[model samples]
Target: MATQREKDAADYLQKHQIMELFDNLTSMLFFYRPDNPREFLVEQLKQLKLSKQTGVNQQNLFNNSNLDAVIRILDPANQSYITYAQYKHALTTLGIKDINESPEGVHEDKISHETFKSEAIEGLQRCSSTYIKSDV
Candidate 1:
């Protein structure tokens, strides 16, 4: 049986249309086999041409700082690499409130592959929706 938290996470992902994004990303990763998912994400953001459409600087969205942070978070084990699960977890936790500080006493900002993917997925969905709704 799924835990209440798991169910809630699923609900959140479904509510925000993040599942679609996750599925698409998963498919792309399976086919592309990028050496570094974090780098791949940066590349995707650049290819999105979001800055051109919204008049915001692309550097703000796909910079070395952000990529480094993501890489660190996604590979909490310090294994110098990440698996698909780690990638998904990092993406899912992107916008979840207090997820790093749940009543269960989870640590905030401590990157772990065990982190739920729905959390980060929510963040990605929010970004996607925001771009879609922008005047671009």
Candidate 2:
């Protein structure tokens, strides 16, 4: 029922995963609540483009602040750790698929702040690389 132009637009967006990009951008904007959201988004997009072009881990979205915020969100009680299940869920939400039973620095069912930060960084970097390669 869509016009040709509309269909083409939808196809283009799907091909480039624009919606997914927007979803991530919006999520970060809300979580970080930067005073200059326009600037923040611009910087994130620039980093993504750079990463895609050079295959470098230059994206600022996976910085320590954002990762720390993610950990805090997952650990609402400030228990200094999240369960393995919680960590997996967090990774899944970030579009990271592959998960090991136990990554370095993480033990048992508890994912401490340092462990979560380290694991999340690696997972996010992998996801970013995969996304860049596939989308290109």
Candidate 3:
């Protein structure tokens, strides 16, 4: 629950509209065009206001089959050069004995074959460099 003070603060902020005011100020004049300056300015203001009021969800904004095919080609395999022993040794060396003691977590940052992650590739470089030395 929001505290009384928090509610009061939010109410005050709503009236002030600090973000809206800042947006207006920051976008006053970028360029003075040669042709129909006022019309261009009005259009620009309309676009800017609409964008600020309603932010775009860029991740789900695009849908292209060609792009998806390209991504599939570039995607990495879950299988790596790291031997099981190398993985075990690195974990042991890093004092991570309790790892895999429990069932593998569904929401873990670790990689699965089905759902690949860019972060996992970076982690493989950082935390398990020794294990990934061999090209298996």
Candidate 4:
């Protein structure tokens, strides 16, 4: 029931929305570091902020048992560093089938610098309400 132009516009919007989510998640996971940022420390996951309204308790999200299982799946080398590729693989292993396709239009293990920059700009635009000037 949609015209071709409207369908194209909707698709474009959805693509950009997914890209934004990917950019934000990547930034959070990698701590905004892009130099050799292919991997992240397991400890980083523990530092994520959780919302109480989500009803997901810390015991379930950050439990030692859960961490150990994830580590086993993501860090087979036991090196404590989980690569982006491994993380994606872990998601797939956990029944996440739509994990590989990235907003970049190709499957990639790590986010590029350009993507990070765009995400930063968008973050700044949304900062007035959520962040203080001093936080910058």
Candidate 5:
């Protein structure tokens, strides 16, 4: 049950083509050891810069021939755990012609929600025209 503000944020991210960017960042967090507070903090620092480095891809994801595969590639898009048919449905809806283009690029895609969230937040800031800035 997400709050209204949270839902709006998600919608904004999706509209800007940064959805996949956030997803990639979220997936990477799994590699860290949650039990170690120090390691957790260190990873957070490293992640702050990642989203910016990824930036929004210059090419439109929907327009690209690889979109369908990308939908499947994103681990979270499968609801953080999804079935193959769900992946197939996305490809079908996106009208992706080739089924196997390798969506490695689309893996982790989201804003890495956090107030101190820097790089990703900054990356989204640069592309602010896509959302947060758009409201202004």
Candidate 6:
């Protein structure tokens, strides 16, 4: 049986979206592999604070730079594209769950970086709005 304190801690984490925040932080850290992770984290946290203060919905927490990094990581051969499956996996990793198909005119078998970015941006916005709706 779980203790009350443990249950409360879990509730707190979920309520504050701490786990999702940590997941994004860890993913970005690994993707960048920066020389100074602490400094990187500080910048990211500052952005997060600014966004929150501005009432910006950033639940999915993805940016153009991160999207580009994801494409590069998935397309290790410098092909400038990734398989549809890889694109889907990348979206899932970025906490984007609402996008089931590529953006219009994108080939499923060979998704270009631009197409992926479009779909990712759409999905991120949708997911962030969903969070806002749920919270209200």
lDDT of 3 by residue, 1-136 (tens): 9999999898765555544333333333332333765776566545545544554211111124532332344334424233333333433443333434222233343323222223223332233222122111
Model 5 Cα lDDT, one tens digit per residue, 2-115: 999999998886675465444433443444436775675455435444434554332222322343344446444544333344444544454333443233322443212121
Scored by TM-score, the top model is 6
lDDT of 2: 0.75
Clashing pairs in 4: none
Model 2, span 11-108: residue lDDT tens:
88877777767766777788789999999988878777777888786743568887888987988899988888888888888767787668654566
Error of 5 at 2 (Å): 14
Rank order (by TM-score, best first): 6, 2, 1, 4, 5, 3
Return the TM-score for each candidate structure.
0.29, 0.54, 0.21, 0.25, 0.23, 0.56
lDDT of 6 by residue, 4-118 (tens): 9999999987787776667667877887898999999888776677566666764455688978787878997979778888888888887787776745444548887888898
The superposed Cα distance between candidate 5 and the true structure at residue 61, in angstroms, equals 21
Write the residue-wise lDDT of candidate 4 on 1-136 in tens digits.
9999999997875654544334444554554454544444233333222312332322111233544666665556655455555554554543334443343412544433333233323333342111111111
TM-score for candidate 1, please give it.
Answer: 0.29
RMSD of 3: 17.4
Which scores better on TM-score, 1 or 5? 1
Q: How close is candidate 6 to the true structure, as a TM-score?
A: 0.56
On lDDT, the leading prediction is 2
Better of 4 and 6 by lDDT: 6
Order candidates by lDDT, high to low: 2, 6, 1, 4, 5, 3
Model 6 scores worst on lDDT over the 10 consecutive residues at 127-136
Give me the displacement of residue 58 in model 4, in angstroms: 12
lDDT of 1 by residue, 1-136 (tens): 9999999998876665555445545654665789998788667555435754765433222334555677776665676545544554554454333333342114343333334333444344344443342232
Task: Pick the winner on TM-score between candidates 2 and 3.
Answer: 2
